[model samples]
Target: MPENPTTEPTPGLENLLHETRSFPPDPRFAEQANAQAGLYDEAKADRLAFWERQARELVSWRTPFTETLDWSGAPVARWFADGTLNAAYNAVDRHVEAGHGDRVALHFEGEPGDTRTVTYADLQREVSRAANALAALGVTTGDRVVIYLPMLVESVVAMLACARLGAAHSVVFGGFSADALRSRIADAGATLVITADGGYRRGAPSALKPAVDEALEPRNGAEPTTVAHVLVVRRTGQDVAWTEGRDVWWHEALEAADVQHDPVWVEAEHPLFILYTSGTTGKPKGILHTTGGYLTQTAYTHRNVFDLKAETDVYWCTADIGWVTGHSYVVYGPLLNGATQVIYEGTPDSPHQGRWWEIVEKYKVSILYTAPTAIRTFMKWGEEIPDRFDLSSLRVLGSVGESINPEAWMWYRRVIGGGTAPIVDTWWQTETGAIMVSPLPGVTAAKPGSAQVPLPGIAAEVVDDEAHPVPDGGGGYLVLSEPWPSMLRGIWGDLERFKDTYWSRFPGIYFAGDGAKKDEDGDIWLLGRVDDVMNVSGHRLSTTEIESALVSHEYVAEAAVVGAADDTTGQAVVAFVILIGEFADRAADDAGADAVQTALRNHVARQIGAIAKPRKILVVPELPKTRSGKIMRRLLRDVAENRAVGDATTLADSSVMTLIASGLAKPSTSSED
Candidate 1:
């Protein structure tokens, strides 16, 4: 009867794609959009000018960029060809020098009830101390160091210190196994390791130093390990086996170092970090981003995309420092812009599902950016959880990690964002280094399921398998037409692998890995990976579409879909649905759940088509996700095909396998069919 009773759209929202979309046109926002418009124009006309303008946006030296981009060397691409600037200075000193020192840079709340307010000045000192400590460890420009710490101050410190010395840092998620850490360490050939003795996890101390120790076990030769020293912070004072002359305590080492280390100026192309990305190689691919150019784009995007006003805004990107979202948004993006932000070291539902809402209320966070998986988790907990705390200060919300299903997207827009804040459905990857295709808050009209339009300077196109542009409403591969300032340099050790993996996908174009469909208005809707698209009865269907169909079912909590081989059709879609707890408990006995399961199958057929319906629907307890909220569909596919799974090392809970395995090989039937 009532038209769904949805919240009214965000005020002053501009439609970057639809020329006819109306807006109130605020002067300040218009002026900014105008200036940003110039950069986009320059980028399209004279590429060099585009990059030079990007550098000028941030604090820089007397001399400006002499050259913009150089890719004459096949694999290694250089950005801001000949420029000098310091990442630490750009992030810390410049903000402090600009009289924003009193502004809170990091509202860091530890998992163990400890709080630290790090202002710009304080951050400068901490970064300097860390820099001096790192320098004393013989770290210099171009040196690569492995950071294996938990979500504590030292993780941020290690990143800043590496930038200060012009050294590249690789931060492996603390949840990763020693073998995973060891692969990254050896690949980077890092001379130093940074970690904590132990860090708080769900109100308890968990050992991290031991993992680092086991990782370095392979290099126990007389000449000493490639990791010359391990800088361990005493988070829990847990007993750690001392490797005489190799293990250095943080308090003793860094506290003794000078707190006024000068920042080292670096070329625009000087490597800032080597973050690893997952792929078929089994060995992780290092996605390298440079200092000046990377931060230039990062700062610009944070300002315009989030409509951030540093002096007043309390921004919080609830991403662990392990992933690219943290590298761009959590630490570098906010700090570079001199914005007050919150960083917590726990899950959304640690002691209670209300943890995130409490943090937002406690810090009075205005802009909260998080993931779809988390939003869905909050949704599972329901409105009562958010109602427990005052989250009215929140003005902007963000989604990343994976495509947010329309249902979860609508739920997030209403519940977490309080119905008025703009949701920036950001889409990018570790290789991209920054947000590329996204809806700019307050500027772009909101789209529930679509990312809306490419950022002004980003040139994205949906191309068919043959590398030809696809028409409107046609699903195809996503590709970048040009390289931007923050594009990855190359794969760390193997340039050929980098070329083969990303570049070779479609020659001359940068492959985005994800499949996409552009609307008649040229707005992009991200489907999952190219490998994720399923061909059912010769009709192409995205796993995202099928999963979305499954989620639309009332009883389903979350769904993961994969294509499995069948003799009749090319492939059959296999779905795994995690039922809602109430329904799950009710259906604990076999016969009770069968009716709901049948309803789910018919739901998918009605939503898309009969051809898109899955041949099998497995009921699993939970879908595997990284510390960041990305589902490991690769592992799910392994489970679907009755194949032994690959790596479960990064999962937050290894016991989830027991839950998933228990459901496998059980007879399943589609409800409606």
Candidate 2:
């Protein structure tokens, strides 16, 4: 007998969980995915068979042989038994052979008003030139190269060039400071660094080559392996310090190098790239991935999840290639499926809040994948902005980063997606190579904020500290029990850290670092980072809980809370809020401030518990954020804790941080702290 025998069942949830969002894939979409998954599953299910199947998926040689995963060598595991396949040929040749050479491969929109549409033929020529130029610089197969440049057509050119030479490319975010760039360059032992003169940011052209020069400067008086030649593309006309022997222009080199070169054939599990990810602790871990299996999974998932029509639809992912969202959507996944995508070089709010809407209207983008933080920002800008433009072409919308709050999710569903398009509230990490769990648009029942369920081959569960499954209606650490395609091979240069950080949390299980609750209806609700959970007066409190409570108030526009030091209790909650226009009246006067603060505190007390009330509330103008719209909570915490700030390099504007710091120094009169 179930404990809920007396209560009614949560209706429609079962339909919500297992239904395929791809109700009717483009006939061939499901057929291709099903066939691919069948081959992929068979290949991986039995280690030996998996490699054989992966080879079969590729244009393989007449030779195939013994050996599976070579983990015994550590950090140097080889796959594909003893077989060979070319990455560039697979990404280019096979599609061309299938009569897609004339199809538009890249519909590129540059920062300026100019546009360039690169067909498969044009892309092939450019890639051949870049590969030969790289060879001239002594970049051979197995060499690591660091790419730190703006979002331009050249970014794709560089990636393909590296693939052609069988070199591992680590693309550091262009916005990252020299220190961040230095860390990745050193970690990968990259001998070559490719940069650009500069690229656009929020509609303005800025110099990036200078940062590359500074980043490559000899460090700590030690001989540098990376003080090598810096290949710069002249994107912006900014004056640059040109070095004769070490700095070479992209145009000059590409002009001289022969435009005919063959891609190197390597084993499947050979290292592809190392993308560094910083967790809550600020320690960056380099995540590694490979060739054959990665492309296979990305291609299969992209086809099924979006039911992509490569020829008809114009797809655009608003994320920069610096982040994992960009890696999967912008670089690997979409391209592997050979879809037409718009690559914007500016922010959603650049020039004005209407920028994103205008792009979608002009390009008629069929699908848009973005972060939840971006949705909330658009919500902050008001719906009238998006309502001004046409968005009917959109069939699918994607959400990444932290789980979206309910109200914002609804706004995204209605306004940006025009209510009819399905939202894939995707859940994956920098560590996970691609979208691990998300709703397939055709088969999945649309949920406002929920990610829905795991992809067909993924196995996820909610487990407690002891690795036991939690009861229904309970929250626990999100974990994966089985290896899925596109899972990180390991943290670069540190397999032990990989085992200790993720695998060790729950032996033989991959810990997601996020806290999740399986509701009574068996639907998983991601609760942000497990570390986001706080202990206030012996009662467990989620920061999202308080933030959500505060946002629920009509006067509140946005809210962020951080636990601070408290002698009486373990920690005290401090909240920073940006008020809506209606709330402006309250922010202007002492009386209004007191009323709004008290009301918000009372609301949280009622919603959660008395102990969960924020001890201090600081009303502010705006939260410091990245270009992509994620709040810089680390900086906000620095303000709350009254500590010297850390790494203000990536903040949208350091002044916003200065504003926050000054405001936080003086406490609000309504505060209990």
Of the candidates shown, which would achieve the greatest lDDT relative to the real structure? 1
Candidate 1 residues lying further than 4 Å off, grouped into runs, are 1-48, 219-224, 664-667, 670-673
Please identify model 2 stretches exceeding 4 Å from their true place: 1-83, 279-283, 606-611, 664-673
TM-score against truth, every candidate: 0.93, 0.88
Q: Which ten residues in a row have the lowest lDDT in candidate 2?
A: 1-10
User: Residues 578-609, candidate 2, lDDT per residue (tens digit)?
Assistant: 88887766667777787788888887776665
Which residue pairs in candidate 1 have backbone atoms (N, alpha carbon, C) closer than 3 angstroms, thus clashing? Answer: 598-671, 598-672
214-240: candidate 1 lDDT, tens digit per residue:
888865452335789999898887898
> What is each predicted model's overall lDDT from 0 to 1?
0.78, 0.73
Error of 2 at 336 (Å): 0.9
